[model samples]
Structures are given as structure tokens and as C-alpha cells.
Target: GSFVLKAAHDAYVPAGQALGIDRDVFSKILDEKIAGHPNIEIVAEEVVSLDQVPRPTIVATGPLTSEPLAKSMAEHFGGDFLYFFDAIAPVIDADSIDMEKVWRADRWGKGTSDYINCPMEKELYYKFIDEVNGARKVEPKDFEKDTPFFEGCMPIEEIVRRGPETARFGCMSPKGLPYPETDKWPYAVVQLRQDNKAGTAYNIVGFQTKMAYGEQTRVFKMIPGLENAEFLKLGSIHRNLYINSPQKLRRDLSSRADEWLFFAGQITGVEGYFESTCTGLMVSMFLDAKLSGDEKPEFARETAFGSLLYAITEEEKENFQPTNINFGLFPPLTTDLDGKPFKGRDKKLKKQLICLRARLRARKVASYQN
Candidate 1:
């Protein structure tokens, strides 16, 4: 997946013919290409019932998919899909914002001033902080257990519950920027940023919340500029579904029963940002070969994609949870260089070398493709 085609071509082939690929942008382009094809009809509305969908389908409804569809998918696949919950941030209509009261600035003006700062007076910030602390939360369904959200991505309400200064240290840390009006840094700032290319909507950065929809709108509006803000969507916490990939999905990403259907991304238990994208690439490669009547290429266990796929699909199933790419997942070094297992000045250098090896292996695999 780190096959920087341009870098590869530049390193090995002639100049000007090199074409580098940003895997993230490449994946989105693939999605758009698949959506735009004449033979494909991507539906905007959710398929409420299986009766409405066509046969021989791939149900990639993702984590936020509905219960009925999820159940149907599970039933058809001949087993239950493992589930978990994820909290989502709320979206606000940009047009509804009173931008006159907000200023555009990045903290300390270090980064791009992409963020719209909604500054708060010391008194107002404290009051809002207190309200979040006192807000009520709804419990999850019986099958779902309430989990502490990830430390880096905790909901705003959760942060407030920790203490009065929690939000300041986390989301509202006014370390760098100063307010012109007061000539003093704000006590806290609720930053909003453009969510889409059109700039018609913005997201409440670090404002993920478990508060009831009704309560969310009421309390959020207490912010000065958001007094009449229109919420496009409220924040929600939900369980995410994941199968034990080592036990369920094969190395080819297909289940034992139906080879035609493939699992990719988080549903297959490939965790983290790049893991999901790598899974998608593997699925595409597997399917492309099968569709074209060619033998699928086997990836080396030492390769990045290969190591990750093997880790997810070949690891001990019972002990399995989501995993990010790490040295432990890769085939270990055999030599004891410099009185250690491997030779490197530090862990960072070791990882860089491992990444380099993986990319070379990926290029070799790609060369085998038609």
C-alpha cells in the first residue's frame, strides 16, 4: 500500500515516467471511479430490506449500518458479525453560524487558519463547563456495554466530567493564540472547521458528545455565536461491528463459504487508518485477478500488506483485537547485530527500515499483476 509508484519508478526506472500514489487519495479516487461507472448504480438511500436489494451483493454498510441490515447480513453470511461502538462528532450548517462573532485562526497561527475560533469569556466558559458536567447521558442497549471512549477522542461531555480544567487541557487549550478584543488569551475556545469542500457545513472539532439530541441542541446553543446555530446532525455513540478476521476471513479476504464476497476495512478487524486502506487494496487485488481469470499473487510475510493481512487472518483468534502495524507483526530479524536482535540507532530507524523492506516487497507483488 506504500507503493509510491512515482518514488518507485524514480528509484528504479527512468525519470518523467514516475507516478507516485498517495494511497489515501488513491482510495477515494477508486470509490469515485466505482461510483461513476455506467454499469454501477450506487444508491444514496439505505436498503431497508433484503427484498429490495439484488442478489450476489457485497454489503459494505460499514459501522453505522442499521440493525435490520446488519442482522440480515449476518444471517446470510451464516454467523454473527462481532460488534463494537464508535462515537461520531456533530455537524453544523455553516450558513446558520454568526461568523461576525467568530474569528478565523489556528492556535498561535502556527498552522493554517482553517479553524474558526468561538472564543469565550472566563465567566461564560466556566458556566458552559459546569452545564456539560451536569448533563444526563443515555445508556447503551442491553447487548452493548458502555465503554470509556478512546483517550485521544473522548466526547466533550466526558472531558467535562473529569474536572473543570479538563476541557482546557484537552480541546480548548489556548496555548498560543490571543484575542484582540481582550488582548488576552481566551479561557477556552470551541473551534469549528469546514467539513466539506463546499464549505456549507462545519464540524465541532473535539466536540463528540453522548448527550441526548434534544439536550445537545439546547446546550450547544449556549455558546455566543451558536445562539441560533442550526445543527445538521447531532453527535452519536454506537457500537462498531468487527469479525475475528483470523478466524473468519481468509488471507484472500473471502469467507470460507462464499469466495465471491470479500471483507475489507474495520469489519475485517484491520484496525487504524492505513490498515483499513490496505485491506481495501488487498480486496481489490484479489477480486481483480479472479475476475480477469488470473492466478492471485502471493504476498511475502515480510511485506507490510502481507504482514498485516497475515496478522489479522492468521493470528490466534481468541486473543485477537484490532491491531495497528508494528514490528511484532512483521517477520522477526534473525541476526543479532550490535549485541542486539537488530542493528539500528533507535526504534525510529528500525521502523523506517522495516517500512522500506515492505515497500520493496509490495512493488515486487505489484509487478506480478497484469
Candidate 2:
């Protein structure tokens, strides 16, 4: 709480969009704070096993947890406790998206019209699939060779490999979302979901891939709205470690097997830097509460903190993937402060109201004292 984050406006996105920071500098700042802390230790030794760890421990062994400890963790946690790989989807600059080719709508018009769908005809979609089938993939390294791919975050290339039309049944499906101009269903579709509150970025939903960076740019540009797209991040797969918190851990992030054992960071199923950092901060509070018998701060359900916590701990138990704190995770806000329905589909104003609600409620969660 005492440290100041150094951030700069990200120029790649639309003006007043997301901020960027040098993560290396941020890590150095954290190191300085930890070094100055009286109770902390700067040990270089690696932990070999969970058995060796004392009770009331906060196990935050990151994505690349050492082999021996990983095994010990699996043995203790039981029931396919940890996942090994992270298939991350690519993000695009919103300003670069061609609004003409893509239309915003909820699937079947059943929910909020937040998704931007890019429709592709049968012939064109198959031709694009041909390119994806042949594109060069980034082969997994020796150490990552045995890592099993989870079905939930399957790579786009892997889908294409199953069959030419296999993708139509999965993420590329046009089942409910109608095609623009024709008012009929598209043969296939590529959906883009908003990645940040500012609406400056959208991610290629279910496009987590292992294609080479150059290949990703060349191949994905085949999509209708992305012909001249500016990619903020390319799809890639890496070895990551995250447990299914909804099934494995409690509300306070303590392991079900032992109340005193806590976990945090990416390993706790939160994605991105700030989400991980906040989880680490919250776990310390939970641990202190356990020791002193004090009530833990319960983050309000409407706040970003609570939305993220709900994602990891209360979302459907099946197909739990690590996630970033996003507006999509927030509880839906249909009416404004005056209880008036959103007369116009003004997304900016809707998001602003959610933010305002979070700000007002976050005080209670931040008020906890040890």
C-alpha cells in the first residue's frame, strides 16, 4: 500500500486507454519494499517439497514451480490439482477494428450486446482454415513436451487440425449471432470481447494459440474485421501453474485440507500483474485473521476485487481457467443510480456506473485493520 506504481499512458491503444509500465522496474520496487521489511527474509534456497514447509504457510510458488515441489503439491491436493500450461488469447487495439465488417451483439440477443462478431462465409472461412492449417507453430520445448493441453483453452490451430469444419462447432461458431447485411447466421464467426474497461482493447476470444508471432499476424488477419488489424499481443502457449480455486480452495484462499495453508498469485487462478499482487495482499490479511481470530475483510460483490475473487472461487467448477479482472466478471448493472433503465445502449456510461459503485463500496473492504 505504501509503494507507488509508475505508469504511463499506452500509446498503441486509443487515447486515454490502458496504461503501460515496465514490469522489471515494478519488480525492483517490490524488492526494495521487501528488503526493508523487518519480518521478511531474502532467501535464495529453493523449496524442494511442500512437506518441508511449515504450517500457516503461504505457498506462492509461481508458474514455473520446481518439479519436486510440484509433485508434492499434486500428491497433497489430490484430484488433478494443478494445470501445467497457459494458452493465452491475443488482444487487439480497438481503434484498429473495422466496425463495418463486425457488428456488436450478444449471441441470440439474449444478453448485453458486448461482443463484436466478425462473420465469414463458408468458402472464405474454409480458405482461411487452410492457411491456419499450414502456418508454422512454435514447438514446445523439451521441458514442456509432456505438458497436457487442457480442452477449455485449446489452441485455434488444434481446432483446425481436428477437421476443416471442426472450428464451426467451437469458438468460431455462428450459432446464435446473426451475420450483418444478410440478417442470416454466418457460416463461421470470430468473436472479439472487450479486454479493458476503457473499451480500447478487445481479445480474439478462444484464439489461444501456439502459432509463431509472425504467423499469428499473417494468419489472423484473414478474419473479416481484422484484415488490417493492429495486434497488441499475439497468442501463445506457455507452461503455467494454476489450481481450480472453486473446487480446491475456500473463500479466504486457504486450502480445504488445512485452514492455515494459503496460496496466492497466478497459482491461485488470477491472471495479469495487478490481480496477482492484490491476491497476495489479501492472503496475508486472511492469514493474519486466522492467527488472531479477527474477521477477514469481505470484498463487496460489486467491486473489482470481489468480481475477481468470484471468478476464481465461485464460477462454475467445470473448465475453470485463470482470468483477469474484467467488467464481464462484474455483476450486471442494468439501472443507473436513479434506478432508470439504460434507455440507450450507452456502454461507456454503463461501465462508468459500475466503476462508481465499486468505488463507493470498496471502502468497507479496505477498512480492515490487524
Candidate 3:
């Protein structure tokens, strides 16, 4: 069934802030792009189930999939796929971090101290927890009320509701690392992890929240190193639906139970609009290769897109969850092509070297393809 485009009057908010679409603009763009395509048709109808569509179908139903279709998918895949309340953490511009108030360190000084740690004194920790508990949060819609939240992805407000000390014991734990200069652990700590290859942004690790956007800014800025932070993106939570891609989908994104059937987008366990778009592109490329009897393209594992595809198609199926593209998903770069050791170097420098190498590898792969 073809969905009608409804233009949203509000500005285009990036995906993960919510599943919002500027429907009117989006629809118009799609219509224009497909204007000259003869085989593409936009029909207005509701698709109730997989049975309604013919074989060799590509499903991109997205996060808000219809109930009947979701049920049909569950039956076809066998066993109930897990449901989770996913949350997005606020991203901060790198230059906005108060570097003097924060220290670079990883727990137990592991792996080049890649994280930025913000220490909070006892009083400050309690105050922060109180503010979080009292902050206004977005209310889940009726349909989303009953969905179970994955333990790993619990909202910060809900964690605070559990108990005042829950945050201290969990993500904010200062168990292994001592506050720099003072030589002692702080009452609590907040960690920020690099979000992009350029090191221009960092996300508050484990700070995924349901707090209203305004409140998120106010509360998060209270962290020691973020007082003057500029948020690139704010925290939010939503009900996300996805299949067990590792178990259900082949490397090419075709269903294991039926090779002709394929899936893409968030439904395939990758998160965000960009990730989903990449999956669609990959699926189309794979289909083209198969139909033309061309050699299957091999994506280099070091590249971001290659890493995301690996995450969805090859990662261990047990405890699998939807993931956004991140360096953690990429294969580690422990040595250079010449076999030189990459350990014991500065964290940021190491990342730079890895990124450079990945880009070179990607270029080489593209050249080979051409």
C-alpha cells in the first residue's frame, strides 16, 4: 500500500530525536525522484500482512510497523523477536567540553584511556540525581506503554526512579578510576565517548534518557565538563521494533527462510535513518549483482558502512540489539599493514590513524570494483 505524504510544518529534526518525518516535503521529494520511473507506482492502500504481497518482496516497514504485519512477521520468522524501549543520548560539540573540568581516562586505565570522565562530588551527585528524577519526561503513547525496555537501554529517568544510588552503581560508577590530581575516586562520574571519526562530537555514555529535550539540556549541562556545552543532539526514547537479523537474515539481507524475501531499514536491526538508508542501498546492490550474475561485491570491514553491515548480518545472534553506526562496530586496528604495533599510542591519534587506514582501504576497494 502506498502511504500519503503529509508535510510536517516543523523543521526537520534528525532521526533518533523521534520518528518524525516532514511528510509533505518527504513525499514531494520521493515523487520527483521517481517521476521518470515507469515501473514504480504509488498506490494508496494499507498492507495488512506479508500474504498480501507477492514473493521477492523487500520490507521496509520501519519502527512503527502495523500490528497485523508485525504478528505475521513473528509467525514467519518463528519465535517472538525481542522488543525494547530505545533511547538516544545527547551529543555535544567537542570544542564545547570544558576540558579543564574533565579528564581523559578509561576504567582501570585500559586501552589508551579513550573516554572523557567528568567527576562529581558527593553533594553534586545527589543533586544531579534529584534533578533527573524530577525532570519532565515524554509520555509514551498507549500502544507503547506495555513494551518491555531492554535492561541495557533503560532510560536515565527510569533508572533514577529505581533508586538514588542506582546511577552511582551503574554507568556513573567510580569503582576503577580515581579523580586526577586528587588521587581518589569521586562520588560519581559521567563518561563521554567519541561519536565521530573527526573527534568533533561525543555522546554522554549511558545517558540515554526520556527527559524532555529542554530538561535534558539543563540537566546534562550540570555535569562538570559540560557547563557551556552545545548539544548537537538531545536525548530521547522511543519504542523501536526490529527483527533478529543475525538469526533471520543472510549476509545480503535476504531472509534465510526464503532467499527471495529481503528486509532493510530499522526492521533489520540497524538504527537511525542513515543506517537504514545504507541497508537499502546495500540490498539493491546485492540484488543487482545476483541478477546480472556479477561477482558479489565485498565491502571492506574497516569502513563504517561495511562495519554496520557486519553488525547486522554477522554479529552473534544471542542478545543481539539494534545498533547505530559507531567505531566499536568496526573491526579493531591493532596493527598497520606493515605489521607495526598500534598499541600504547595516544587514543585520539590512534583513532585518526585507524580512520585514515579505513579510508584508504575503502578507496582501494572502490577502485577494484570499478
The estimated TM-scores of all candidates read: 0.66, 0.63, 0.63
Q: All candidates' lDDT scores?
A: 0.71, 0.81, 0.81
Q: Extract clashing residue pairs from model 3.
A: 6-24, 7-24
Displacement of residue 203 (Cα, Å) in model 3 is 15
Give the per-residue lDDT of model 2 (tens digit) for 1-370.
Answer: 4243322122122212234343444556667777898999888888888878789899998877877887887877886655566688898999999998889887777556778899999899999999999999999888678776766678989889999989999999999888656679989999887766467788898899999999999989999999999999888887887887898889899988878789999889887767887788788878887798887778888999888888888887566777888889999897776778756578888899999989977875676542
Query: Per-residue alpha-carbon lDDT of model 1 for 335-360, expressed as tens digits?
Result: 33233567546777777767777777
lDDT of 3 by residue, 112-136 (tens): 6778899999999999999999998
Task: After superposing candidate 2 on the true structure, give the runs of residues whose Cα lies further than 4 Å from its correct spot.
Answer: 2-16, 87-133, 139-209, 212-236, 339-344, 367-370
What is the total number of backbone clashes in candidate 2? 0
Clashing pairs in model 2? Answer: none
Arranged by lDDT with the best first, the candidates are: 3, 2, 1
In TM-score terms, candidate 1 sits at 0.66
Looking at candidate 1, what is the lDDT of residue 369?
65
Q: After superposition, how far is residue 353 of candidate 3 from its true place, in Å?
A: 2.3
After TM-score superposition, the amount by which residue 241's alpha carbon in candidate 3 deviates from its true location, in angstroms, is 1.1
In candidate 1, list every pair of residues with a backbone clash: 6-19, 6-20, 84-239, 84-240, 85-238, 85-239, 85-240, 86-238
